[model samples]
Target: MIHQPPVHFLGKTLTGQPVQKQVRKLKDLDNIFLDQAAFSAADMNRVVYEVFSYLPVDEGTEGGLFFGMTHLYPGTVGQEFYMTKGHFHTIENRAEYYWCVEGEGMLLMMDKHRNTWAEQMQPGSLHYIDGYTAHRVANTGGGILSFGACWPSDAGHDYATIVKNGFSRRLLSVEGKPALV
Candidate 1:
């Protein structure tokens, strides 16, 4: 797949016309809280950002290649960076790949056993999230943090696990920079 920009931001390209797409809003993330003091259940209805998935060739297919973009707005809850609700693939054996197309952030990954890894992300940085690993993205930049990702269509997100237990570690904003907390 090519660049998956927001539908409203697209125009006709020389290759082909941009397909109309749906926007997935992820505003309710109180369940996946690491810093309880920072996240408030009353603010769960607040909109954080949105995701736009593009699968131009997948008419009715599953377990095939699908790519999309995640635009994370800049903000913070206390010292914690704004982040995505991390999850594992429900299919258990389907890996996913993420590439930072714009802005700067950090990818936090962990396994069922709590083995953790943190990677800094910026324009052109790439990361491979192995199967069974729960992953989340944190925006550390001053503006929007945009990243593109691809994975098998059948690798559904299992967010309940992460919501229930949370990640082994958390990403915090330390002096306006990302730090492991």
Candidate 2:
């Protein structure tokens, strides 16, 4: 995938197309067995950043691949250290789903209006975010918030950067999401 910024701010590619980039070797992800995933607050931030490089969605994320999601390495995220800040993903349109593959955490659901609700999650847990729903992934335990996301479309391409910071996210539409109801 190429990120050709508009000629004005991104500078001129003369051809208007971004420089050509190719996919070479795929990065090898860390080998973590379930027994190793015991999240502690001190390691939360670093692990999240490190695992981002290996997310299934690590395309342009690593090399510009789009339409991807990460099966969070257990213990890579989720710390009771602080609250899971909020964020949103807007594509041409938006629809999102989170499937818990491993570990557990708390999901804090906040609407555009900022009303909130919280739910505990675990492996096999299916958390669906049908757009319009403002949400946060909180680490309510000593484990990582390892999970997977299913976008109805390629909306997550934009979300890759945003979710990592764990803050500075916007809930584009508040209309459909039930306000933590």
Candidate 3:
């Protein structure tokens, strides 16, 4: 098979070619957020985040890498910050890397045993996520929180598992600062 060409990206934007974009609105995370009352009263149509992916090879291709950027808008539901729907890799052993390009946030991770941890994400912060862990990002800043991610093309996402079993810990705003609870 022929080799796929390199993909280029600038800051939080993908360049040189068109990418597949997925926008997640507040309504898309009906049961993901912790506060039911805040979720119900908020504007469901408001955009929460967007993912831009540049896939050079077909998904699930071993040895191939997929690159993407997640742009999480600043907002809150009750005291909880805006976040992505966390997921584990379908392969279970596929690790991934995330780099904070801009904004401040938290990288929340939970292992298979339900143990949870979080890392502060700032500009230039890099995080290594191990396999078998469910991971999610929360935007705690007042501006857009953007980050880049790289993982094996074969590392399929398992969102359903997280939907059924939510994260053990949550990142919430406390007196204008982020706190893990």
Candidate 4:
């Protein structure tokens, strides 16, 4: 089922698309799911993919490609739940942010200088960080930590995915034939 402009988050609806009404979903997974039908292409090449999961971007090599996302989940009644493991980023032009729709937690942040900071994140709370800032989300409640994340490809480069993964890297720029810091 098609909808108007600015459809819901993650570009889809939980109800699934009308074209595949016959599909059946197993209810016990309590996993990350994306209602793909709620979103549409802005142009010929653009596309949207929505899903529910415990991980973000999981494991991949699309680190250099620009992509955006939004997440919505209901908080549970536990203290050990979180959207993802603590992580760090390596990109240089990412603009990332998160809006906590439910539950409470701490916004973990670390910078290139190896400094750290933590801020409380509750429902209706929002945080936006620069691309160079490394950070992650830490849930500390007996409820589901629900939030929405939306950012350009630049956002990924500015996140804490790298540190969370115990990684090291070196990139060379052909323009000046030199390595970047």
The numbered model that scores best in TM-score is 3
Q: Predicted candidate 3: what Cα RMSD to the true structure?
A: 2.2
Tens digits of lDDT, candidate 4, 65-123: 32232232322112122233334444455656676776666666666665666667787
Candidate with the larger lDDT of 1 and 4? 1
lDDT of each: 0.76, 0.39, 0.93, 0.41
Highest-scoring model, lDDT: 3
Error of 1 at 77 (Å): 0.9
Query: Estimated TM-score per prediction?
Result: 0.80, 0.45, 0.95, 0.48
For every candidate, C-alpha RMSD to the true structure in Å: 4.8, 14.3, 2.2, 16.1
Where is the poorest 10-residue window by lDDT in model 1? 8-17
TM-score of 1: 0.80
Question: Under the 3 Å rule for N, CA and C atoms, how many clashes does model 2 have?
Answer: 7
Candidate 3, pairs of clashing residues: none
User: Lowest summed-lDDT stretch of 10 residues in model 2?
Assistant: 24-33
Candidate 3 Cα deviation (angstroms), residue 23: 0.5
Cα displacement (Å) at residue 81, model 4: 6.3
Tens digit of lDDT per residue, candidate 2, span 65-118?
A: 322223222232121222333456554235566655555565665554545566
Query: Which lDDT value does model 3 have at 113?
Result: 98
- Candidate 2 — which pairs collide? 59-63, 59-64, 59-65, 60-63, 60-64, 60-65, 77-145
Off by over 4 Å in 4: 1-3, 10-83, 154-181
Model 2, which residues run further than 4 Å from truth? 1-45, 49-85, 91-93, 154-181
